[model samples]
Target chain A: MKPAMLYKLVILIGILITGVADAAAHTIIVHPSLKVKNISQALQQAHNGDTILVKQGRYAVANLGIDKSVTLLGEGYPVLDGQMKGDVLIVNVNHVIIKGFHICNTNKGSLRNYAGIRCESVKNIIIENNRFNNTLFPVYLPKTSHSVVRNNVINGSSHENTTAMESGSGIYLWYASDILVDGNSVSGQRDGIYFEFSNGCTVSNNRCKNNYRYGLHFMFSDSNTYIKNIFSDNGAGVAVMYSGHIIMLQNRFEYNWGPAAYGLLLKEINDSRISDNIFGHNTTGIYMESCSRNQFSGNNFNMNGWALNILSDCTGNRFDHNNFTGNTFDVSTNGSPEQNSFDANYWDKYAGYDLNKDGIGDIPYYPVSLYSKIVENIPYAITLFRSFVVSLLDKAERAIPSLIPVSVIDHHPLMQQYRKS
Target chain B: MLKIAKYTVYDIARNKIILSYAIFLLVISLSLFMLDNDPSRSLSSLMSVMLIVIPLVGIIFSTIFIYNNSEFIELLVAQPVKRSYILLADYLGVAGSLSLAYLIGMALPVTIYAPGTTGLYLIVTGIALTFIFTSIAFFCAVISRDKARGIGMALLLWFFFSVVYDGLLMGFLFLFNDYPLEKPVLFFTMFNPIDLARITVMMKMDIAALMGYTGAVYRDFFGTSIGMVFTLILLAIWAVIPLIIAVQIFRKKDL
Candidate 1:
């Protein structure tokens, strides 16, 4: 009843929804030689809807807190150094905009989250085109909504010392809603983008690279879409846990390799759509545990170890029109007697002939081999992976069916590799 | 060559020691399976046993077999038979008998209790190890005329490959700990036959979690068909290359 009501409400009054933009009534220029020595004094003298333009100069200051609805714009990327203290900029009121500032060098406080910019209980905030460097957390928002954070460059400390629990990450959205995070390049943070209890957000076109932990962490967040993001060189990769109705589209996961690493880890995620993504050179391209009702289609998995690893309890997942090429193993899973359909995917391991020349194999291809089953049952059996006898057993199993599970099968295997436009 | 091979196999088949070897494997594998209902656990236990005992028994038995049959080999050399044929036949006879015994002993218990990929892998790797170590034994025997020296050399070779090689690999990794050793260590692993055989079986077992990053790297390398083919070829070369060298050396030696 609620879902239908929402649809009807959107349909009936869709044209009535429009945004009102407020105009700035006052303008002030802040220079080093002016009465306001720095941004803090300028901010103190400013009122609501006022725009303070900061000229280019380096400011060595403590935390700058804003309590009014004002715009703090930098004319030439004014340097705001935190001097190894706390947050460089803190916004406590609504309708604030912090743009074009080069904020850097915040010491990672053990108890508190030291960030380049922190927003508390604020709405309609615009944080854009800023550069953040050597900060523990950058662009952090708590209990805020309807905000935009885009075109930011966030660089953090070396990812090696990421074992600290509270440390790392860029652009953490906590208890926030309807946020737009786009066009950001985040590197060397534990996780590039982390969302906790945030919903209805759109994260797109972000390049997240070389993070020690996950490139993106979506925990307990629902109705979020991550589109066209590139996640590379992060061994912990991307983990989407306890979330539902998420859309992952056209994302590229590459070069995330380690023993426990994977391109994507989906745990307790349901009703999700993973479509048109490229997963290349990862240890395990996609690993799902206790996930159900997920649709995986049009994804390219290339040159990965253990391309798809599904746990025993996962069910009702469908894999269709996905290209599996040059991967070590197409699929490995614990013995799950559940049903999942795999259809029309191009597999380099497919040996069946296309009898009618329709580019579809005449026989159904079993992507799960006997050796994969062995490795699944006994993880230690992974050591025998390169033996001659193992290959011979694979061949023998191909000719003669053995104890390999037959739950997952691609019915209409394509004769050629899948090409997308 | 076929005639000598046939005679050698027939002679080894009637030997009491070979019969006892088959019975020994049967008892050990069956008891291991009976003790544990979980097929994977049993297979792991049997794997360790096979790793240690197979190489030891293979090298020792083949070395003794060659020493005992040196007189027969001399008689064959005096005949119209080629020296290469005599060496090849003797090596094949010992390897074949040992592998056959291994198959008979492991087959019933594995097929009945385990009856899956793990069972099949155990059988296959076990047979390959038998063949490989037996060939190495032939090389040791052919190189030295002293009976005690040949047996001692075979034992030392097994110890070096099974134990020393792994230690050296660990030490090398420790020395280069600062560098990314994942890619280089894979190439280094190919030099040792025991490591190859053990890894082949271990990769099938469920212990990737324990192996962690190193395990994942190994899985990436060995999970492919190409890696499988390469490792198999390497194992085959390990078995055949020594026999080839042994044949070459035996050809010029005085009986």
Candidate 2:
């Protein structure tokens, strides 16, 4: 066939598919208005390309496996109480939509992966605007793609039990691709939003707080974008590990404090961009180990215990145009063969004069202090942090630079806070 | 010994240098507190001054004071007073006077402006530095007969503690920079009193961030109770050993 004929044939196929959908689609209402009393009965009576509209009522249901090209629409936020038996709903087929339901109390299932709603091996679906309570692995999507999980509220496992840290996550995505998880509020789970082996995903505008472990944990997930998310008061804010090509923008990581806790732990991540994030009150903000070629720009590190704990072996990472205010130590590194760049950041500890008035500082700022280096090797020496000797040593070193990673220099430090354009 | 120590303290208390030292401390603390809006920055400013100035004054003042009052010391020695008593009295006199000045000059301002652990830490470290340095001064003064050489020795001691020691540590670290030196460096810090004093305060200030994982490891070793006790005992040793050496020298000296 000619090129034009092939295009016409593709359009004809698209029209035929839509026509078949329109022809087979039916609306099945499960309510007192009809003879059907329960959703299961309505579902049994429905066919492919059907819409099962459930009315407002308490429905005590068993495991629901949806395997059709259907839409399950709930009216007035109908409650689906599982009474602690098994997964409330499971979607085994593709091209499905489940919206506007309140689901709760999914009990122990056989696979140890029983979820409130599990989408297994499904494609082209949308699970939106639902509220979940006490559901392990709520909105679990395994091997899914080209789907959306938006505007949902998940009040996952109770935080009262300390062992809740081992429970399931709020929205778990494994082996998923091109998924957009947006505008969700999740709390009280092992992790609020998790992505494992998921790629090309956009996790944006989520409020994940007070979780048992990490609010957002990304592992082996590549080419993802996380923007405008607030992760706070969790055991740790987020852990992005063994991944690359990540763009983290405009996120707020706050108040994640503990001996082992941190705002963001980036390990073995390469060619990533972390920009415009606010890191506040975290024990260690942005702890990087073995990460390379990452760009950190326009971030605000405020009142954190340790703003940047960039360990040894991290190289080619660029820290530029960030504002460091009131952190205990703005930057720390183990003395090793390392190469990284710190440029044009506004440091509160900068004592250099901008005599030329070009908005950039005339002199460079050494983010690593002398005493910090001493304490790095001799941990007990931190007790002497406030001592005059350490202060003078740091000042003296700052004046006549030596020993402490001279390669990591803020060559063009900003006199003012760097405002992102 | 107590009576002589009391009289010496009173006598040194009235001296112009003691008064000026107190006044200088007062002015610096008050000015630093007033100048920086951030309480932490001001605390840092006060701490550095306390570290550098306190140790220097303790050594210089005690050496000069003891040497200038050699006639008085000889007069006391000529009396029925025990040899140990006279030396102990002069040492107590200088250390007590300096300690009082530091407490009066620093403690009040710190309590008023930046109270809590910060104030308490600064005061404690200031007191330790004072006691340690004065004892060192006493040892240097009693060990050497020439006043000028003694003063030179004291100044050199101050310079070594305050500057050269750190430079040397930096050099040692550079020589062995390739190895994992956290443990060895920590052991090395205990040898220097100034380094010891500095680390104790920094740990308290929670700038452990600077230390990173090394800091956490330090905290694990120190904890709260054990760390403070360790610091106090180390400081006590620093004070007592010097004074004992001074007493030994004083016993054998021909005044």
Find the candidate with the highest DockQ and give its number: 2
Candidate number achieving the greatest TM-score relative to the actual structure: 2
Give lDDT for model 2.
0.85
TM-score of each: 0.66, 0.74
lDDT of 1 by residue, B1-255 (tens): 877888889988878888998999999999988875556657766876787788999999999888999999988888998899888888878888888888888767888888877677678778888888998999999999999999999999988877676656655654666677666767777887777777766656633332344576676666566877777888898898888888889999877
Q: What would the DockQ be for model 2?
A: 0.19
Model 1: how far is A128 from its true place, Å? 0.8
Which segments of candidate 1 are over 4 A away from where they belong? A1-24, A158-166, B1-252
Residue range A6-102, candidate 1, lDDT tens digits: 9999976654442212333567788898877788788877889889898999998568788989999988899999988888888999999989988
lDDT of each: 0.82, 0.85
